[model samples]
Target: MQEEAYHIPVLLAECLEALQIDPAGTYVDCTFGGGGHSRAILDKLGPDGRLVAFDQDADAAQNLPDDPRVLFVPHNFRHLQRFLRLHKINSVNGVLADLGVSSHQFDEAERGFSIRFDADLDMRMDARSERTAAQLLQTYSEQQLHKLFEQYGEVTNARTLAKTIVTLRATMPMQTIQQFKAAIQGVVKGNPNKYLAQVFQALRIEVNDEMGALKQLLEQLPEVLVQGGRAAIITFHSLEDRLVKQFFKQGSFEPEEDHPFENKKQVSLLKVITKKPIVPTMEEQKRNSRSRSAKLRVAERI
Candidate 1:
């Protein structure tokens, strides 16, 4: 595996602007991928300012900042609240989270995050994590597989695909990306690239329990942020973006119910700063195509 940083830090400038850095204040970067955003945040902070970065992947520790103002936490961002409290931090000026698999994770073929490369079926972002994609495939029932394929992968033939997996697992355990691909070749409808990518994405998400982790992290944001503190999140998928959007706008995951007898008081702990998400500029897309789908949503604590 490459030891140096591998991620390009999509929409770098936009993220910085959304964060609205305070030179004397403290900040937390929940996803310290390749340290790109962390470095940027540090640049905008003063000598007294502090930056606490968190990355679950042990490999990411190599890129830790050397300055005393920066603190590195080798744990999942889902533990944001517990860790923050440990540092005697009740609130922060800004928080940034660039969610999803980092470029470094995708570049390493052995990590098994991308479909472009032939690698092991292990898709754990944190190598120490117990579950692998293969184990998940082997253990998940047909109905569970169907739900994952349909909800996460958006595969059109989820039912047939799940049924096929159940049949194949009876004879053999799907252990590698190549093996999984080969086993499901019969159900790949059209456009191999698109179909395979979706399947791999679904597996990766499940292996990492990404959505669950993200929800846990988001839930802590309200309590961890001070009044007017900012949280700038960059989500790459519709599901994540929608969750962030809804939370920032309405203060809760579920839609609000109308009450005729009472005035609608805002339950929201955050004020959505971005009426709509900020997308990468065309110039940025040309420079770093990985940023094309990046969506930035900023919110201020209420």
Candidate 2:
């Protein structure tokens, strides 16, 4: 896919400003989806500067620029620390992660990320991973599905939806997008499109374990970023935004037992750069409808 059409970097200028690019320092782009943000970061980096970019999607590798200064890692950002050490890098001058699902992924009918298409119910960002949305739906207990829909998707009739899924799975197959949608038709609440979108969002997040991966990345920030270095995260969902906001402001995330870092001294090691998330300008939202929900939060490692 062409970089231009693959994904438009949301809040482009704001993200660059947040990084305060030091031409000779090293940087990290945790989600090198379309390479849009990475390419822009590269423009600000001098020849001696380095950029370590990461993405699990094989499609992303196709967009890698022909530059020796960049070290691209074909893995999820959750493994940020592991890969950084593997490459003999201890700290970075700045870090960025745009946590939005790329337009390319949604537009590609076969990926099953969008509600518009009828395809295999697979929402894996990395094809190498075995879990798929179909597997979750077929296997999860009714209570588990209820919790997923309620917590992740905020589906209005989540409990009912879960019950319906359990009741239907016994007699019908829910192996594809069309099949699942048809199966859940009787219980969809409010707007059909919006309801299905929420349902899909929950499944996608669970199948990929997005929140888990994000927490891992956040926990690594204090260790991987140098003092005064910046972390600019762009989150599309409120839940993801809240996690970043809390981690940047408090250096802690939800669920103490599930915390990614063992060294959680309950003290924040970063300074919040944006008092509130910087949202896309009206002009940008007009140009790209997908960017309307985007929120950019920047913080400096203290």
Candidate 3:
């Protein structure tokens, strides 16, 4: 499949500007979904510049560009530090991570990323992973399901939905998206599409351990980036946006209380560049609806 057809890069110009790329600098595209962002970065680089791109999805490998300047790593960005070291790279001038599902994953029905498709309940970004959405639905306790739905999906009737799944799955195993949707048909609130989307979002997050991976990626940024190096992240939902916002602002995930020694030394490793996240313009949003929810946050290493 063509790269563009796989996934359209969100906030291309904004992300590039945020990175402030230097002609000969080394950069990392932490999530090289379809190589759109990586290609653009490559365009701005001189012959001496290098780009390292990461994607766990095997499908993305076909879209890899044939450029000596670009080193494609078939691994998850969660292990960014380890992979970079293996490549003899200690630090980078900038890093770009576009978080969330790629368009190809959602479009491919068998992946079970989109509620629009009726396929197997398999939502593993890396197909090699053990757990699938079906496995999660079958094994997670009621309380675990409730927490996942409420916290990750923000489903209004999470408790009731979790209970319903627990009761139904006892007799009918939900191995397919259709079966899962049928199981939850009674509890769907508001628009059916919206509700199912939320449920699927929660499952995908858990199956991929996305939040945990994002935390690991964020934690390693300061160490991976050189002084004045930038990190540009595009998040599809508020959960991710909040984490990036907090980390960039305070160098911690949780809010810090004022202390007597607050000003004694610098605690923040990153200085937030975008006071507010940069959203796509009206034109760009119209061009690609998936870009509508994207929030691009840029930060610089202090």
Cα-based lDDT at residue 259, candidate 1: 90
Clash list (residue pairs), candidate 2: none
Where's the lowest-lDDT run of ten residues in candidate 3? Answer: 257-266
Clashing pairs in 1: none
TM-scores, each model vs. reference: 0.95, 0.96, 0.97
Candidate 1's residue-wise lDDT over 1-302, tens digit each?
Answer: 33234788877898898888889999999998788889988999999999999999987888876799998889999999899889898889999999957888888888888887888799898888899999898999999999999988898999999999999987865788878888988889999989988888888888889989988888889999888899999999888899899888887777777899988755888899899899999998898778888899999998
- Candidate order by decreasing lDDT: 2, 3, 1
Off by over 4 Å in 1: 1-5, 259-266
Q: Give, for candidate 2, the lowest lDDT window spanning 10 residues.
A: 254-263
TM-score of 2: 0.96
Candidate 1, TM-score vs. the true structure?
0.95
Writing each residue's lDDT as its tens digit, candidate 3 over 1-302 gives 78889999999999999999999999999889888999999999999999999999999889888889999899999999999999999999999999968999999988888888888999999989999999999999999999999999999999999999999998886999999888889999999999999998999999999999999999999999999999999999999999999888888776677688665433789999999999999999999998989999999998
> What residue runs in model 3 are displaced by over 4 Å at the alpha carbon?
259-266
Worst 10 residues of 1 by lDDT: 1-10
| CA deviation > 4 Å runs, candidate 2 | 254-265
